[model samples]
Target chain A: MTNAIEVTGLRKAYGSVQAVKGIDFYVERGKLFAFLGPNGAGKSTTIDILCTFLRPDAGTVRIGAYRLGEEDRQIRGMIGAVFQDGLLDPLLTVEENLRLRGGFYDLRGRALTQAVEDIMKQVGVSDLRRRPYGKLSGGQRRRCDIARALVHAPEILFLDEPTTGLDPQTRKSVWQTLHGIQREKGMTVFLTTHYMEEAAAADYVLVMDHGEIAAKGTPSQLKDAYARDKLILVCHDTARTAARLREKGLACTETADTLELPLASTLDALPIIQDLREEIRDFEVIRGTMDDAFLAIAGEAIRE
Target chain B: MMGFALRNLKVFFRDKAAVFFSLLSTFIIIGLYALFLGDVWTSNYEGVPGIRYLMDSWIIAGLLTATSVTATMGAFGIMVEDRGKKVVKDFVVSPLQRRSMVGGYVLSAVTVGVVMSVVTVVLGEVYIVINGGDWLGASELCQVLGLILLSTLTNSAMVFFVVTFFSSTNAFATASTIIGTVIGFLTGIYLPIGSLPETVQWVVKLFPPSHAAALFRQVMMAEPMAEAFATAPAQTADAFREMMGVQLVFGSTEMPAWGSLLVLLATALLFYGLSVVVLSRKAR
Candidate 1:
């Protein structure tokens, strides 16, 4: 089967400032892809182009079989987007908004009604269908937003910061819902997020910075390439413990109370911890996280 | 197009405050006319037969035109609210054409304008009859209805054009408040045209909605004025019509009823064309 989307040298600029400068990537069907970036890193501009809301300055894009500019309406028919804000009318009930969206795709009568009901049930929003969207709770509103996107049953769903403002428990629930939908329907999901832990859940990840792609790979591959595992030690004598580790050809940095060692991999921490048992009072071996890997690649921690 | 238009209408009517505020100016005018303006104007021709009926018909005609203008402006609030919240971006990304969405808003406003104007005319007629004026003849009522439809279309086009430049709800509110106050004077209801200075009277004549008011007055008050001034001279009635703005004169030329209708039609076309051009240019 063809890839869900493809873009080559996509570039978009507003006046003199370039928002997305000549980028290339593609998403396979049925894959969850995460595009990670800080503010002004061009993730939004790129997503805007992919969602057909913006035109690239110089590049070509193929969404399924249709070209971006030449066949935007057809692409619009095949994809849906959940924007960061104001995607649904606040005064309208959730069911009404979904029905309106379904009607926009030319679905009518029983089909539109059925689509709205099915999607609401799927997104766990059936009980809130009659509530005005503005009156919904935070988590309820987010689920309704997702249901709004699925009313037309688009093949690809583009989520822009889907869980940005939700609490941790709500965020986890939304992700579970997304994963369930992607698996059950074999739909492709493309999401951009500032939360590193969220990107760790994606099948593939692309990190962008300064209007360019800083890195792209699966979460494990990125962690392996750019992050390192750490072995931390609190001992009777922190200074002496560090010296003893350096004598064994293992480098360590000594804090006032602990000796820190960076290992080549998580398994490397086993032998080092075992060897330092006598000198250590307590120890912890911490594996690399998506945050650490991102910091290594972007040269700074992701800011909220 | 029809689906979106229906959505706009549903949203508008569902918001109870929107429906009430759209007719707010009409209610305010009726109250002011009864409380103070009524005694002042009717006192001039105290003993003239049918004078109260004539003045009542006259103010109601002006109120009908004012209703069309204000009600349509209120209906555009939905569009302005959507734009302010950036919900229009969602519609843009959908499969619907941008032109169709804009058409939906304009059509809904026209519907609201016509509905509000018709309600005003109905109530105004009842009030006139209660004041002892005879009901309009069949042909006269037909002419009045036709004028209401024309006035609504012209006002909708004009309102759409003006609303294009305002997206924030605060700006819309401020504009509405200003238009609500100014429309009364422009319709020559608050202050009669002949009583105003020569320059401001020119503004009242040039305004397209004022012409709608004139056309309405010509149809609605014709019989009552004729009866009231039967023993009086023709010059006396003509002068009274001119003073009260039952008819509008432009630069020493008395404009016929057809001339005012032409002005309404021409301004509607001009504004609609300008609106299309402005919208197309604004699009990427």
Candidate 2:
């Protein structure tokens, strides 16, 4: 019924470079909103301004019921953030780190202890509570980082590229954990990421490029408007297959091992597959994805 | 603010290496004095009654003053390390007030300065008594302890101001090394101010910790000083006290104990006000 975050004409600059330029967006409460952009885009800058880490040159921002600059303390109390860098003290144990972070929010004594235990358990890191933060694996440390931010039971969570350096399996598990927490707590999540599939899971997506919002919409809507599903054929000889398709006036792009023919509809796959017969080693009519939606809208692939 | 301050203290104490390195300069000064400088100074004052007591007290007082400066420098290193690793940003984004954050760091520095300086005083007293010197009386010991608090406040405030220019731990370490080497000369411990050129003596007199050192020696070495100069003419005893840096002389006017104490108090207040202004501006 209300917006979790609202911004209008938010602008920020560093010397000669404009990091965020007159951006406007609002995320609904209890929804997972993904902010997607390539390298050097304004995604991180926007998040920093919203989280009160950096002061914007000009803007009107409201987080829940609190104003950005004027009521920053209240806004900070309502939000939790996992920074792009490791914020945990390496020498401190996981439990010690959690308690210290809890102390920052003025949570202490039995109440602090209980909150720390509950958050650690909720993030599946209760068993690692006594372990030193430096000794934990990357995935484990991330779990602890998330648990630290959640100790205060913030109403909104800001995750800045939370899974950037994690391995694929670890990334997937973190995603699942994030989804689980969001679903269970019904807290608003504002995420910035370069992974399209991660953004694909969001109820709403905002794509930024070169300090401006290039596009914003739901995944399905963007896919319908700008992206098309492709019928991909992985063959022993994709060059010959591509030549054959081109002779028939069917436009297809060929890579080393596959030929990608954009399909207007799923029904078109039936005729193409039947005509190819034994020439096709393997084929699948893949559905449209946020990757395509992003490429079509942002005009560049997401840089790692 | 208390929680943040306590967290800093815990982090400093838990890191054995940091704790050791923070007091490393103090130990080095004492070690060098015991091995080489101690004999040289004692030989110069040979046959002066209670010379061992007076000279030992002088070096120990200087060491105590140095301890607060060096230990506070070490304590501020945590702030630099946290900034380098971006851990400070975590605090910035939290609900903690900016004043509280600055206050936490300032309080931690003061705590470290006082705690480590007290330990140094204990060690110095042990060494003095082993070398056949007497401990201070109740009133004298209270005066020494009171000076420790004021000296630590001044040192903490001064160091906090210096650290604001640094964000990287490596740069801060370099600054710490520079301070460690230069502070001895400024405080007139490495070389007595009377033996130096007049301009150099002026510099030492103007240095804040030099005043602290003067205050510490005045109270700590009073009994020994009285005994050593008991038979000498009043002017000669006054001259010896000035030469040894137990009393500060600017031109012909001798600075009284109250003057040095006032200088220390003013130094503490001025630097603390400047540090707060700088921290608040940076917060903005």
Candidate 3:
């Protein structure tokens, strides 16, 4: 597949602090690409540069065939951005907000009205059409923001923490709506999120830390790399078993009543299992998680 | 561009404080003027008769409309709100032309000006007729309307320029009030510019409101433009006439009126260009 977004050696600094330090990544067309990072890890900054809201100090960004700087207008026309903030006017009704956005693309009259109605219905906010935007709940406001972004029918959608501050159920609904749009329109979606579950939903993921890409691959690829082969040992006292195993030169972590150990091979796990049967109440082997991959790559717990 | 302009107008009307204050303030000023000057309308001042005094009432109405509407905090509100909400980023990235965006804002200001002017004219005329003064004829009424429109345009442009370049709403407000008050005093909105000190008269004559007031007085009070020109010294009159001659070359002989409009249009264009440049640089 052709790349939808290509960036090379991107570097951005704020005074003495470096925000994006020579990071590189590419996102394939028509795929949902997730950018995972900590709060100050330059996710928003990179997205800003890509969305034409900020000019990169030094880098090459190519969205489709258009280069960043040289073809910003054309690139901007092809992309729709839902920024971190809800940029809708508080004074305008939901429908009015959409109509005003649609006007930017020269849509007006009956055509504009119909377009707004269709988008609102598609986003499941048609009932709130006449309501002022400030009156809507957080989720409804985000949905309206998304609909406004799509008013111009852009080829790519850039969402910067679209579900931040949302409840779980609302976040799920937003994901579902985004998935529906992607399925129906085949628009490339570039999303930045702190939620691991949201990151797992992407077709590909790029884990960022300290202004650099720590790792990039499919979710399963990352999981397999860090956690595919793992053995879980449940015992009467996990701490005792963990100490005994460590004393015997085995790597293990105790969690409540369970002991987890990274096994080089299933054959290597058999001896430990056989020897520890007396101390173990139960044992099982399982696949790894995206969180484990992130921890392994960033050298820190995902939640922290 | 039409969409932008219409949207701004809709938003302005939806603002309760803006709509209420604009209409309320215009009526309050006219009511106060009528209460104080009701008896004076039937008496003669200088060589002008009582009817002429009543006609000249439109000048006060026009000035009040211009001062109140042009001194509105709407421009600052709009710009500051856009900056705070980051809505300006959307426009900067959109395909909408920069000039069109400025035009939309200016048009919104003009709409407010026109609305306020209409309210003052209607209420002021009602008071004149009810208090035993002759009603204005169609031609005279049209002249008053024209003058009000010109004054509104001029002041709106000035406000637009001030709000565009200054980021601080407080600073804009302070500056607008000082400028508006000074112009009002120097032009003798409550007195006569001819009675001001020579230095103050020179300074006031340079103000758009002074020219605007003079033009309005000429049209509504039936005073000859030449008589209005005499308020300034001979050298100043020559310079003023030459400036008017330039306006005449552009197919308009209403010097003070057209001069204010031209200055307003030019300043609007300049502020708009500067805004675009600043936005572009910041976007980078």
Candidate 4:
């Protein structure tokens, strides 16, 4: 399948200050692509350029098949976006809001009704269709926003900080709903979020820093490159165990009751554990988390 | 565009406070006239013929013209609120054209202006009859309705232009309140045109809504005006007409009805053009 979005050398500047300085990325069709960054990391600027809300200083951005600048109106019809703030009318019922959004895509008569009904059911908000949007809880409002965005059934969905202010349970459910929609519709979901775990779930993650891509890979690839796997042992002798491991050519950190082995991968911890099995009381291997990878990578970018 | 317009219409009518506040000035005008202005004017013009009918017709005309101004400004609260809540971004990202969005706002504001002003006309006519004045003839009523459409267009265009400068709801609320207060003075509703200083009277006369008021008076007050002046001297009727803003008099000549219509038509076109220019510039 072709790329759902293609942004090449996208450079956008506000007067003298460059917000997105010559960045490039693409999202494959039917894949979840995530951009992870801090507040001023140019994630939003780049997304705005692709969404045709902000014109880039120089770049060729194609949304699905439509060009960003030349075919902006067409691109708009082919994509849906949910920004951080609530944009749906508070006084309007869930169904009314969906009907209004579907109207923008020229859905009317029976087609409009069908689209509204389909979107509500697809986003699992069918039960709340008649409820006023303002009366909904935070999670429910977020679901309505997603439902409104999908009313037109666009091939690509752009979400800016999809779960920024929700509680953990609500965020988890929101992500679950998103995954369901993406799976059922084979939709390309491109989102920018501050949550590392959210980005880890994406098929591809692009870490941005200071208007540039600091790292881009699968979660495990990033963890392998920027973070380490741990091999820990519960033992009685702290001093002798450390010497025995060092003499046998295993590098480890010694503590009062345990020795730690930092290795390239969890697979690398096997041989060390096999060699130290007799002296060790118990051992366990810990895989690095996305947060660990982020600290090791984005932490350096922030410090510099 | 029609969907957006319908949504705006729905939202405006749903907010009961907004609808009432839009007509708050109209109620104030009626209250002032009822409390003391009505008796004071009737007593002051005791010797004149048909004085009650003339003053009633004058206040009714001023109320009709001012409704378009206040109601449309209140209607524009939706536009400013949309901007403040960032709801406009959703429309910007949709397939809806920029012109369509703008047209939706203009259409809805004009609709609200026309709807509210017509209601004012009906209520004003009923008030006149209850005060012992004859109901306007069908032809005159039709003419008044046509005038309502035109004046609403002009008033809404001007209000929409002013609203483009505001985005916050607080700022919009303050602006609508200021506009509501200033509308009476602008249309010579709170006081007659001749009551102001000479230069200030010119400013009121130049005001587009005042011309609308004059046009309304030309139609609604035509019979009563003739009755009031039939027993008086020739210049007396002209003085009363000029004082009460029934006719916009220039330095030496009275402005004909067509002249007021021309002012209103020109004002509508000019404001519409100005609003489009400002909006297009902002888009760029």
Score residue A192 of candidate 2 by CA lDDT.
89
lDDT at position A142, candidate 2: 94
- Model 2 regions lying over 4 Å from their true place: A234-244, A254-258, A278-281, A301-304
lDDT (Cα, 0-100) at A231 in candidate 3: 93
Please identify which of the two predictions, 3 or 4, would achieve the higher TM-score against the true structure.
Answer: 4
Ranking by DockQ: 2, 4, 1, 3
Between which residue pairs do clashes occur in model 2? none
**For residues A201-295, what per-residue lDDT tens digits would candidate 3 score against the true structure?**
89999988889988888988777776457899999877788889999998887777788888765567789989998998889976567776777
lDDT measured at residue A177 in model 3 versus the true structure, 0 to 100: 89
Estimated TM-score for each candidate: 0.96, 0.95, 0.81, 0.93
Which has the higher DockQ value, candidate number 2 or candidate number 4? 2
Chain B of candidate 1 vs. true chain B, TM: 0.97
Between prediction 1 and prediction 3, the one with superior DockQ is: 1
Q: What total of clashing residue pairs does each candidate reach?
A: 0, 0, 0, 0
Per-residue alpha-carbon lDDT of candidate 2 for residues A99-207, written as tens digits (9 for 90 to 100):
9889888897999999999999899999998898988999999999999889999999999999989999999998888889999999999998878888888999998
**Ten residues in sequence with the least summed lDDT for candidate 1 chain B:** B1-10
Candidates 1 onward: DockQ, in order: 0.70, 0.77, 0.48, 0.71
Best by DockQ: 2
TM-score of 3: 0.81
